[model samples]
Every structure is written in C-alpha cells, then in structure tokens.
Target: MPIEQGSSGNNNVGIGNSNPNAMLTVGGGAPLFLNQGASSTTPFLAVLNSAYPTDARYGWAFYDNSTNGNLDIFRRNGTSQGIQFMSFNRNTGDVAIGESSPLFLNHGSSNSTPFLAVLNSVNPTDAKYGWAFYDNSTNGNLDIFRRNGTSQGIKLMSFNRNTGDVAIGESTPLYLNHGASNSTPFLAVLNSVNPTDAKYGWAFYDNPINGNLDIFRRNGTSQGIQLMSFDRNSGDVSIGTSNSNGNKLAVRGTIGCEEIVVKSASTWNWPDYVFSKDYKLKSLQEVKEYVEENHHLPEIPSAQEIEKKGFMLAEMNMNLLKKIEELTLYMIDQEKKTEQLKSIILKQNEIILNQSKRLEKLENKL
Candidate 1:
C-alpha cells in the first residue's frame, strides 16, 4: 500500500491522491470493504456528519445477523432525528416500505397520511395504480379505495366494524328495504348489465309485494323469476314461488322424494257441534227434501262453486266431518226407534200367550 500524508493530518492510502477534507481515504478502489468488527449486532456501515458532534447520528444501512439476517435502512431528519424508512425481515419475509414497525407485507407510516401508494411515475402523464386504507369520516367505517389513474378513483370497499357490515362497489350501496328489522345488512354482489340480453344470476331482495326476503334468479330483463322466499315475520319458507296465494310452500316442478313426513298441528275446527244441545236434529224427510231441491247437501259448497273458487282443504275436511257427525246422530236415533218397536212386539206376544191359556182352561172345565 502506498501512503500519502496531507497538511491537515489526513492519511491517503492506495495509488492516487486523496481529498484534503477527509480524515481517511482510499484511492483507486476496485472494491473497497470497510469491515467493522465481526459482531453480528453492530452495523456494517454508518455514515455520520461530523459537523453535528453533540447529536452524533446521521444515516445507516445495516444487515442484522442475530435474528434472521434482516436488512434495515435508516435516514436522519435533522441532527438528532433518526428514522428507519425501510426494513426487510427475513424471518417473516415481510418488507416494510415506509414503515419501521410493520405488521403487514407493505406497510406505510407517517403523521399526515399513513398509507401505501404505488406510483408508476412521479409525473402525472403516466398511469398510477395504488390502494389506500383509511377511516371514513361520515359513517366511521374502515374504507379501502383503489385508484386507476392519478385524478379519478373510486372507493373499492368499506367495512363497518361496529355493525359487522361490509359494502362494495360505489360508495352509496343499493338500499334494499328489509323493513325495520335488519338495519345494516350486507349485499355481496349487485351487477347491472344489459337488460335485453339474458344474464343468468341470482339476487336476494326484500320483496315489497309479499313482504318476504325473496331469492330471485334473473333469466332475462323482465324482472326476476322468484326461485325461493322466506317470510321474515312468520318464519315460513316458500320454494319455487313466493306463495303470495296462501301456500306455505309451492313448487313449479314435480318433486321426487323417498319420503316426505309432515308433522304439524291442524287448524281445522272439528265438527263437535253435532253433540251439542243447541244442534237441530232435522227429520230424514226434511233432509231428503233439501237434498233433492238443492242437488247437494245443506251448508256444503256445490260442484260449480268448488270449480269457481277452488277448494280449501281445511274447510272441505271440516264440512265432511260435519256430515259424518250428523250421520252418527241419525243412526243413534234409528237404533232407539228399533228398540221401542221390539219392546212393543214382546208385550203383544205375552198378551196372546195369556189368552191361549184361558181358552185351554175353559175347554178342560167343559
């Protein structure tokens, strides 16, 4: 090594002349290795400005070998202000861009705007793409916005942490009025495409007509075909239809099943009125006359009426039970009449036997 001593007590080592201000300088460096002590905790390079002697820190880039060999770069704001801007954690494989205490892969930290913004170019002409996470001021929710260009962007999604509701797409989501029960319900996807073309998709809507949470399948543009529905108030489930016409469940296609078991309390009012004291027991003649005149039983709907208004199963069952109870009463009345006639014949037979005995006695005396 060739050495040159300067007037300012500076030492220059190697082939060329050194700058006068530098304390120690190396000339003609193919590669210069400034190796600190072999301690894993110490930094490999520390560039400090000697002008600020009291606040001695400046900037440093180091490889930490103690843990998982992480590379950390730090910058100084002022004489005493040192801030770490970038870190690569080898253990977790996470790179902190503008943050020192990073929790995620690309974390950002600042006092003004703490977010990560990826830019294509510093100039406005190039396309910029980035995503920002922030708190929404209006509703006090967590919002994530995605930017396409520099100026124009849209809010990608938001989450209300308090209510556990998430919203996607445009800021103002579609308001599906689910009455007063559910306040903050989330909608997964709402796609509005061309109306004329047949687009196959499904949607859950609060139907105003039937007052149900209806699941509808969109086949074309002419509204949506109701696939299923649930009565939020009554807890009734309707399949293949909304059951707007008084059916608990309705299916458009034939059902194939191994077994279907129905367990329910019947709502039909049984015909116990026949056993009541106020029940009017009509004569058989009167019942026959009424049936002949009307061509149907009294208080029962005729065939024409059934065809016109359709049949109510519960009402039809109750009517049939009433007829059965009336028939039972008629049978009991006939049984009582037959018992009376048999008693009269027994008395007639006893009288005839006594008259024969008297005739036999008169003949013996003669």
Candidate 2:
C-alpha cells in the first residue's frame, strides 16, 4: 500500500512533510494549483537556448481551463499553475515528456509557418542591428527588413541592407553609390534594371565638374546638365570653373533666367502703332492693277554712253584726270544707257535754244 501525505497536521492525518510550505496546495484532493513546486525545493524553472526544453522530451502533470497556465508565455516563481507545466531538464535542458502526453501538433490548433525566421548561418553573433527582415516570406529571394534606429518605424523602402549603398525593387533598382564615402555626397543610377548594360536609365554625380551635382540621361546617346550643388543653384545648366577666389561662374549656354521671351516683328513695334485702330492692306488683285496703271520708265542712255562722255570730257578740257578715272569705274558699275539718254536730252535742248534765237532774229529783220 502506498501511503500519501495529507493536510491537517493534528490527529496524525499523516500528511507527509507537515510543514505548511511542504504540503502542496491541493484543490479537490489533487495537486494542481500554483503548487507544482510546493513539493520541490526550487522556486522557478530555467529556459535554455531560447527554448523551454533542451531536447525533445515533452510532459505535463495536469491542466484545466480555470488554471493560470494559459495566462502568459512565462511566469514568476509564485504564479499559479495547477499542473506541472513542461520544462527543460536541469542538466541537459531537454524537455521531460510524461508517458501519457497528448499529440500537441495534431491537436487541431493553428500551427503553420512562423511569423518570423532569422537564419544567420554565416554569422553567429547576435542580431545586434535592428530588425533585418519583417514579413519575409518563402519566395527564395535575398531579402531584408529595415527599421528606424529609434522608436519610429520604417519610413521608406524597408528591406534593403546592402552596405555602403541602398537599393530598391526586386533585388535592385535605384542604387545610391556612397560606397566610396559613407558621409560625403554620393553617385546614383536610376531606373536601372541591369547594372552591366544599365539599360533605359540615367546616372547622377554629386559635386560635379565645378562642384555642382550633375544629372545625366542616357538613351541611344547621353546628355547631361548640372542640376544643383552646394556652391551654385542652377537647373538644367552647365557651370564653369571658379576663379582664383573660388567663386561660381556660369558657363556658355547657361542662361540666368528660366525662360527667354521671343517677340515677333509686329509686337516689337507695338509702341509706334499702339494708337492705331486697325491696319489695312489692298488685296493682290488691287495692287496689280495700281502698278500697271502708274508704272512707266523714261528713255535713258546706256551706261556705255555715259562712260564715253567721261573720255570725251577729258579730250574737250571739261574733266579733270581724277574725275575721269572715278567716272570710269563708276560707269562700269552704273547703268551706261541711262547716261547716254541724258546726253541726248542736253543736245536737243541746245538745238531748241539756237532755233528760237534764229526765229527771233528773223522777226526783227522783218
């Protein structure tokens, strides 16, 4: 016969270890209430390797819904739990499984993929940095999760952990190359799907030719302009070098203004014509008729005739040598027939004057 200890130290109720603390608190004649360790001397159980049991041993004394075992993941020494909850062994830290333990996994409880899994097979140190990956799924891609160093959560792309650089989109997208310097300005490539060819993308250089950040677009050809800088603030521009004093200077084709205003001929002369109400122009047909009626040219000597006069003037003692020489070159360029016509008019005028004089003399004789 197995003799068991009972409560009520008087009258030899025969409870073993009559010390009040040693007699485990029994509810309904069973030891299952905040008293798993009441029979033992230890106060709390130890956890090893972040797991309850070191090895795969599992066991349970007893548990009921009314008990506090389901309250928290871990509890203090004096907390209430009617059952001897499973724990790691004091030596190897493996779990101790009772013979009649239930099948925990097949208990119809929800147990699927875990919410977080960190495998640092390469590095064995602690996860000293913040969260490296959140919501990392099983898609077989290299992924990272990011967080603010402080309380605030992640602001931008969260899961990019390439050092000395930052990347976005499916393994790589926008790459900011500050690998040269962690603190200073950096270079970047945008919309880059492939780093080898860098197709359909642009490159950027911070603190460019004359200390200006330059943005360059690439297509079949490449074109670039200075965007901004610590020294100069210009958009779509190219900056020149500084003088000995180290001041910013504008290069050629870098205008000061954002846009240039071009004016048409009519609008440019608006001040002169501002008061006019309307402008008028006759049609092409009217213009043709007017020109036909009024246009006529008087008969003139050829330029050759005028040049001959220059030669004759020298012979007749009328022209100086300098004048004749000047006229010769002028005649070559000017119209010659017009000059000949003028000479003919002068001769006719002299003949008319002589004839008039003869008529007057005849009248007086009569």
lDDT of 2 by residue, 76-158 (tens): 22333223433332333223222122111111111121122222211111232233333324422233433233322232332
Best by lDDT: 1
Model 1, 248-329: lDDT tens digits are: 6656567899986644347745789789989997889999999999999987999999979767666777788899899999
**Lowest summed-lDDT stretch of 10 residues in model 2?**
102-111
CA lDDT of each prediction against the hidden true structure: 0.54, 0.35
Q: State which candidate has the highest TM-score.
A: 1
Scored by Cα lDDT, where does model 1 land?
Answer: 0.54
True-structure RMSD for candidate 2: 21.0
Q: Give TM per candidate.
A: 0.40, 0.28
